[model samples]
Target: MADITAPELKQRLQAGETPTIIDVRETWENEESRIDGSQNIPLGSLPDKLDELEELKDQEIIVHCKSGGRSASAKAFLTQQGFTNVRNLLGGMQGYQQS
Candidate 1:
């Protein structure tokens, strides 16, 4: 899936589309600022949480972090684990805040 820009994500949220968004930053980072409704699942804990997310394997899942690096890794990892539609949030939280 193509990565989603912060503006696009904001638009979707405004339109009342409940996209499945995953914040891959650490708990403290997520607590600092976050897109409302996005799930906080730090990248390091993803493997252990796979079972909880199994139902969403074929669904669209957006992942983001403080910057873009960790979420990019999260996207790659999820895709490798049989997730068919995984997207990274471009520029991550920084971009989202800027937008």
Candidate 2:
């Protein structure tokens, strides 16, 4: 997967599709606000948390950061780790806030 827009992702969530939403922001950033049901894992700790995501490797994953940059990196890292269905949330939470 390439990237998913906030509206599209929100629709998918409302429809109950269980794609894992990974928030690759720092703890303070996450505490400020985050997508409901998203997993909080800072970008730097992603490598250490790889095992935590093992079972989700086969599932679709939607990653987001404050403004999309970190999420893009997260997407690349996940792809390298053999996650077949990973997507970066375009525009990240800022986009979500808009709609």
Candidate 3:
């Protein structure tokens, strides 16, 4: 899976382009902090949640978790599911915070 650094993602979002951003963190972790406009779908539930994101399969989808691990998994899963443009958020929210 390709990676989008926090800073790069930040810039795209700030420009107001609507990239599909999925947050794969737990509910509690997301409740604490998250990138605005990202959808919350825990990593464990992603397989079941694909239907909800079908419209995004052909679009650029950015998956993120606390520090990139879960997002990387999500990216691979999405790609296998026929999502051609899935990208993992590098360093996840931790890197976003630093950026």
Each candidate's TM vs. the true structure?
Answer: 0.98, 0.94, 0.95
Candidate 3 residues 24-90, lDDT tens each?
Answer: 9999999999889989999999999989888887889999999999989999999999998998999
lDDT against true structure, model 3: 0.91
Worst 10 residues of 3 by lDDT: 1-10
lDDT of 2 by residue, 1-99 (tens): 768999999899899987789999999999999889998999999999999899999898999998999999999999999999999999999999897
Global fold similarity of model 3 (TM-score): 0.95
Q: Provide the lDDT at 27 for model 2.
A: 93
lDDT on C-alpha atoms for all candidate structures: 0.96, 0.92, 0.91
lDDT of 1 by residue, 16-94 (tens): 9999999999999998999999999999999999999999999999999988999999999999999999999999999
In model 2, which runs have C-alpha deviations exceeding 4 angstroms? none
Task: For candidate 2, give the lDDT.
Answer: 0.92
Q: What is the lDDT of residue 58 in candidate 3?
A: 87
11 Cα displacement, candidate 1 (Å): 0.3
Q: Report each candidate's C-alpha RMSD, comma-separated, in the order given.
A: 0.5, 1.0, 1.0
